[model samples]
Target: MMTHWIKSNSTVFGKYLFVKGLSQKVNSKKFEVGKTVFQSLNGRDLLSFEGYTRNEVYSLLWVATELKNVQQSLRLGKRVGLIWSNPIAKASLTHASQNLESSLCCVHENQLFGSSNNYEMLGRSLASTSDIIFLDVPSWSQSNVEEFAAGSNRPVILISSRDLSPAVVYSELLSFYETYGFLRRVILVYLGPGNNPALNTYFTVFPTIGGHLRYVVDGVIESQASWEKGLRLATKFNTEIKQFEKVDEAIDRAHAISTCSHNLSHMHLKLKDVKEMDLDWTFVQSDSHKGLSVSKDLMKAAGHSLIHEVINNQSWIFQACIAAHTSDYRPIIQPPRFEGVD
Candidate 1:
């Protein structure tokens, strides 16, 4: 049956079986067998495993397949390493390991809170291991991706925020390239909207391969203050109460407005910190997680904004900021409490 599945869906089933075979062997190997075992499996090995009805073999196969996909994605002509910091380091590592096509390596606890040289050494060691290195350090200013790239042969990618500013962004990119030629691409992931408009304008001023900019509107949108009162008045008075008439009319007008425009306006407002007092009108609102919430209206608006940004700007690298606060996004995956810098 497994063989038949492989023959029918060779692309999918073959990968599935290969992953299964690797899991069975990983328990015995001390070194990283994930990359190796996946490469070894072929049709013959898969067919042999299928002959045995052992549930263990089946379970191992499932894990192997998933890991294989991740490995292949990471090893596709580019070695990618993810660096994390503080509380977010672990979660980011877990997510990157599962989702990104690259190996996830965290900064050591001792090195994290140590001297600048220690951090530099750690970054160098990590850069040496892969073609692409993602530094999840707290402040991009303190990070030394360029130092690591001095000895590295691959590209170094840094994930940072809007607070870093365009000047900081340019300085880092220039320093990396000048110091170490390996800093081919610097991908900045900006999270705050505090200076998004200015940041957007700044990136447009210097659009180049050396530094690619991406923005993330990282916050939730809540319903307008009037929404609750309007709901209550409508429920209590129905159409008979003249006092609630204006509320009803406002609700109708809000509903008539295109949901996309409303959501987009909401996003801009949230980013710009636009308050109810500033708005002459009101619209329905709800809290969204990292990206748009599951609502069709909000999703469309989010998608439209993303598309517009990408088209207008070159190398706009936008992504959902899973970590809440700036400090929450740490780069060191595992470190003792004492080792963390304030």
Candidate 2:
């Protein structure tokens, strides 16, 4: 088979003529905004996970939060860590708190918050734009290759580019792996619109060597809000909704449901607070837990719970919130001594 290489800059960002031959096209410069000058990668190179455990779910949330802050810092040309005490339900993290900090060049909780920020004058050195965005994905050029090649536990080095054939990417990466063994695997994502079936199916053969954490295209078309399609697909896949492999899609729909539930009561609540407030009054009970009662206080808390236990125990955190707010939002409906957050 004959192979032809073409170089063209994306209209989305016309600063640099990038693509598979970016190293040659932008040979003069070290890095361009969206152009890394490394090499193109297949969409299948993106990492994917089942996300069926609390740890996995928690890690995703934590990573996303950190990535958001990192991206923001880069945009601002600053390198300060964001405070992380309030966004999530407090829980002990195994790999998140440290690994994430190192990855983002962030201050750990103790340094950022527990220690005085207002009192002590602490500042992080600004990172170069390219330092935050692009690098040689195979082995960082600025760093020690021997340190990276020491073991098989090397971290993921994502070099996102499009229009590169899988054979070229796989061959190049495979060469690097055999020589330096720097990256454990390749991670890829497409930034443009519409479905790229060819790119999406890039890693089907090398199942053990790639993933899709950033881009999991489900062919949703122009629809912004729709779970019926996902549900229907779930049925066709011969799997219960709870056991669907597309857990990210399930979580997205769950978020939509919870968002709709907020319309019933503009305010959110805690279960304990709801119970204390309604101690004397009577309300409808959930059919699943009759007599035990469902507190609409915050009808849903999804990400906090694990996947298997959620299905087995029949958790209705979100449903309860919807029911409670839908049923009544009047503060006067309280039974007696029910003090809420001021």
Q: What would the TM-scores of all predictions be?
A: 0.30, 0.19
lDDT score at residue 29, model 1, on the 0-100 scale: 15
What residue runs in model 1 are displaced by over 4 Å at the alpha carbon?
1-79, 86-102, 108-111, 115-119, 142-145, 151-153, 161-342
Model 2: per-residue Cα lDDT over 272-310, one tens digit each:
643444322111111112211223433453322121222
- What does candidate 1's lDDT look like per residue over 218-295, in tens digits? 232121122222222222212110111122232221211111122333233331222232322212211122334224
Count clashing residue pairs per candidate.
14, 14
lDDT of each: 0.28, 0.22
> Over the full model, what C-alpha lDDT does candidate 2 score relative to the true structure?
0.22
Question: For every candidate structure, what is the RMSD over all alpha carbons to the true structure, in angstroms?
Answer: 24.2, 23.5
TM-score of candidate 2 on Cα atoms, chains taken together: 0.19
Which residue runs of candidate 2 sit more than 4 Å off their true CA positions?
A: 1-97, 105-232, 239-261, 265-342
